[model samples]
Target: MEIVGSRRKNSSFSSADDAAVVSTIPLYRSAPELEVRLDDFELYAIHRLRVLKGISDGLSRGKKPNEMENLTKELWKVNMRNSEASEVANKDIISHYVLRLVYCREEELRKWFLSMETTLFRYRFQLETTDAQRALLKEFDLPYKAVSNAEYESVKEKLNQVVRSIGQPLSSADTIYYKVPFEQVPDLVATRRVFIFKGYAYVAMNQVVSLLMTQYRSHLSKALVLTNRKWTSMILEQEKDRLTPIVEALSTSYLGPDYSQPREYGEISLKDIDQVAKSSFPLCMRHLFEKLREDHHLKHGGRMQLGLFLKGVGLKLDDALAFWKAEFSRKVGAERFDKEYAYGIRHNYGKEGKRTDYTPYSCQKIISSTPGVGDHHGCPYRHFSEENLRAALDKMGVGNRAVQDVMDKVRNRHYQLACTLTFEAIHGASCDAGINHPNQYYNDSKNILESRVRATRMVDTLMYAEV
Candidate 1:
C-alpha cells in the first residue's frame, strides 16, 4: 500500500471527474507484475486498512442523514474501485495514515489499534497463497527457515510425537517445519503446539500463522508506542480536525463478536431485576447493585453504570424511571429523587438532553475508567485489591480454588479473563470465551445455564427411550 494525495489536498472540493482520475491510478502499479513484496511496516499498514474501514463504518452510525449519505457514497466508490490494485493500495494507505493520527492520541487507543491490525494481519495471511506467504515472510525478515531433509530426519521422532499429541497423524516427512526462537512465540509454547529442541521451536508450517501473528503484534505494539510519543508531542490542529471522526468512531466501536439485539434476550421487568442481579449480573455490576440496595443511593458514576446495565437488560423506560425513583425515595424522599435524579435517568434513556441513544459501558470502557472515592463504577478485577476481591468472592460462595484462579488472572492484569473465570466458577461450567463486555458476560451466563438444562433434558430423553 502506498500513500496518495498530499496532507493539504482538499478532497471536499474535488469534482466527480477529479475523483475518477484519482481512482484510476493503481497503488501497486510500480511493483513487478508477477510478484509483490511489502516491507514490514507496509504490511502492518496494509492490515490497518481493514481496521480503519471498520472504525469508519462504526463512527458513521449516528451521523446526520446528509453526512451518512456522503459516507455511503465514499464507501461505495472504494468498493467499486477495489478491483483496481492501485485504488485498493491507495485506500489502504490513506486509512492507515488516518488511524495513526487517531490512535496516537492515547495509550488505550493505541493498544486497540494494534490488536485490530494484528487480527487483520492474521486473517489476511490465512487467506494468502503459498508464494504470497513466502513473499510476506521474506519481507518480515523472520529468523525461521524451512527445515532441510537432513534436519528433518534428525528430528523426525520428536516431531511425530508432538504431532500425535495434538491428535493429528501428520508424518515428519510430510510436515514442513520452521526453526524459530521459542521465545518469539510464547502462545505456541504455552499451548504445547510446537516441539522445542535446543533453543528453537520446530513449528509446523500450517501452525506458523499463530507464531507470525504474535511477532507482528509485538513489533507493531512497540512501533505504535514510539509513534504515539512522537505524534503526541506535536500539535497540528487541521490534522487533528481531519482525524476527529476516526477517533470518535474508535471510542464508540463495539469490537465484540456478538452484539445481540435487545429483544433476543427476552423482556426483563423491573420486578425481576433483584433476582437477575443475584444470578446474572457480572461481578462489577453485582457489586454496584449490592451497594445500591444497601445504601438506597449511588454516586453519579455508579448510577450511570447500573442504569445503562438495567436499560440493556430490557427494562422499559417507565419501569426504569420508577425503579430508580422508588429506590432513591427510601432515603432522599420522592420529591428529592424526582428533582435531583429524574433528568439524568431520562437523559440516559434518550428522552432528554441530547436525546442520543446511549450504549452500555463495555468491558474496555469499564476497565480503563478510574473510579474516584465513593464511586463503584469500574471493574472489580481491575480496581479491587487482591484481599478485597478474594473476600467478595468468598462471600458470594465461590470456593477457595476458584477464587485463587480468578485472583491469578487479576494479578496479571487480565481483568476480563478474571471475569470469565468468575463466570465459569459461578455457573459450574467452563465458558471458553473471552469476556469483552459486561452485557456479553450476562448473556453468556444465561446461555450456559440454559444449555446445561437442555443437555440434562436430552440425557433424560435418551434414558427413557432405552428403558
Candidate 2:
C-alpha cells in the first residue's frame, strides 16, 4: 500500500520493517497491544477518542431519554454548546456533557487535515475516471504526495473548497471541517451563543442543518456512491427501501463524493454480501437472540428467526420497526407498536437499545448475507470467535495480520481491524475500503464512528458535571 504523509516516512528505517513504505506507518500491534504512529495517526486517534469520551460522559449523567438522544445526536457535530444553534431544540429537557480528548498535537491535526484533501478533492474534479481510479485517488488516505509550499497551498485551497463548502462553522470548539451527507452547507459553521472556539465561525443554529445544508448535501447524501450517478429509484430498483441515508450521502457536493471509496461496483454484489454474511451471520443471530432473552426478559422463537432475519436485511430501528409494524399490523394491529415499535426502537437506536441490546442490523450486511440470515438485518461477524474468524479468513484467504506493521493500525484506531478482515474474507483480496464496519471496518472506518461515540461520552461526562 502506498501511504502518504508524515515525518517518520519522510525519513528512512531498517530493511526488516514491515509495510514500511514510510517508517511511521500508523498501525495497531495486536500481539503486544501497542499502537504505532509516524504522525497524524497519533493525533487523529487522540482527537477522535477525546471526542467520544466527551459524548459518552454526557450520556452517563442520567438525562431523560429524549434529551439524552438529542444530546447524543449533537455528538455528530463538535458542538458550539449553543442550544439556539441546534437543529432540534431539547424541548424535553436540558443537559450538559463533558469529556477529555488527548492527542499528538496541532501539527498532526494540520497534517491529517491537509492529507484529507487528496481524498476529498479527488471527486471535485469532473474527470472520466473509473470508480476504482476514483477510489484509488479520492479516498482520504492522508499525507498525500509531498509538494513545495506553493503547491501545498494550492492543494489546501482546493481543500478549502470543502471547508468553505460548509462556508460556516458552528461556534468553534476547535473548528472542525468535514464533508457530510448534507449538500447545502456552504462553508458552514455554528456555535453556542456563549462558548466559541477561536479561528472558527459563529454560525446561526439554523445554518447547521438547515434546508440548505440538507439540500446541497442531500443530493450528495443521496448520490449513488462509487459513481457520480445519483442513487435514484431508477437504479436501486427493487431495493429502494434499503437505500436509506447512506445512499443519500452520495450527492453532497462538499462531501458527497468520497474519492477514497472504490466505485459502487454497482449495488454491492450478492456474492460478496453472502460471502461476508456467511462468516458473520450465525454469530450475530445467536447474540441477538440472547440479548432479547436476557436483557428485555422476553422470549419468542421468532426472536431468533425473525430478529436475525430482519437484522440480516439491514433494517435500522426506525426502518426496522416500520418494516415490523407494517408486517405486525398486517397480522396483529397497530397496538403491536406499543409492544413492538417501542421495544424495537428501544432495542435499535435508543440508549435503552444500546445499553442492553448490543447487536443491531446495518445496511451493508443485509445486502450481503444470505443462506445463513439472508436479507434479515444484523451484524454477523462479532459473535464469531477469533477462532471462527480465523477459519473464515483463512478460507477466504484474507485473514493475515502482520506484526507491528498492521497491528499498530488497528490498535491506534488508524484502521478498522475487524471490518477490514471481514471485507478481505469475502472478496478474497486486499480490502482497503477504510470505512469501518462495526465488526469489519478499517482505517477511516473508525474515525467518524469513534469520534461520535467519544463526543457523546464527552457530553455525557460534562452534563454529569464530571470534568
Top TM-score prediction, candidate number: 1
Poorly placed runs, candidate 2 (over 4 Å): 1-276, 279-388, 399-416, 428-467
Candidate 2 per-residue C-alpha lDDT over 23-139 given as tens digits, one digit per residue, 9 for 90 to 100: 111111111222323232233333333333333333222235355445544543443233554412221111110000111112332223222222222222222223332232223
Which regions of candidate 1 fall more than 4 Å away from where they truly are? 1-105, 143-154, 169-176, 234-236, 239-242, 255-276, 279-283, 295-300, 312-355, 367-375, 379-467
lDDT of each: 0.67, 0.33
Pairs in steric clash, model 1: 26-86, 27-86
What TM-score against the true fold does each predicted structure earn?
A: 0.57, 0.23
Residue 34 lDDT, candidate 2, scale 0-100: 27
Please, what are the lDDT tens digits per residue for candidate 1 over residues 1-467? 10011222321222343333322211221222333222323343434443444433333122443454354445434442445666565545544544565576677677667765664555556556554564555455554333336666677788878888989876633345667788877878998978887888876666677777877777767666665665656534444654444455555555554332354576688777888888889989999999988889999989998888778878778998898888899999999988999999999888898887777887777776778998888999889888889988887668899898888877766677777778888888876556767888788777877788899999999999999
Give the per-residue Cα lDDT of candidate 2 at 80: 24
Worst 10 residues of 1 by lDDT: 1-10
